[model samples]
Target: DQQVKQNSPSLSVQEGRISILNCDYTNSMFDYFLWYKKYPAEGPTFLISISSIKDKNEDGRFTVFLNKSAKHLSLHIVPSQPGDSAVYFCAASAFAGNTPLVFGKGTRLSVIA
Candidate 1:
């Protein structure tokens, strides 16, 4: 079974609009969650994260909401720009600091100028 899944492999939106990406996880042991963004050919870079203790976390134009009861999470990006076009991956780790993470394949966001 896919412990982590991003059902949609790609998403498209116009510049200055809102973009939403959805993710789901089956493992209840996952206590920490993270979102990473990647440009072509580069490793994913950390974007935002939330511990299972919090329901939501926001960072400027990016926001992540976690619903532990439902095993669901989503990322929202506002004022999307061409520069924001990239692959986004959702990861889960049970522990903090150097623990390996389980990753969803990724969702490619295309922001048209």
Candidate 2:
């Protein structure tokens, strides 16, 4: 069974609109959650992250919300731009210096201009 899951295969939004992506996890030990955006032929770039201790974290146009009790997390992008189009992956890991992240299947987001 997959520890992390992204049920939506894809999402589309018009430019300047908001885009929301959801993720769920089965592992309760996971304390660190991260979101990464990947483009074709490139490595995933780190977007935003949240610790289990915090309910929400935001940076500029990106925000990550974590609900520990529900084992769920969501990523929000405000004023979505065309450049924001990419595959988003949600990853989780137990708090450790070098623990590997367990990743969910990516959700493709297309931002139309």
Winner by TM-score? 2
RMSD of each: 1.2, 1.0
Clashes of 1: 0
TM-score of each: 0.95, 0.97
What digit string (tens of lDDT, one per residue) describes model 1 on residues 16-68? 99999999999888989999999988989999998999999999999999999
Candidate 2: clashing pairs of residues: none
lDDT of 2 by residue, 5-31 (tens): 999999999999999999999988899
How many Å off is the CA of 67 in candidate 1? 0.8
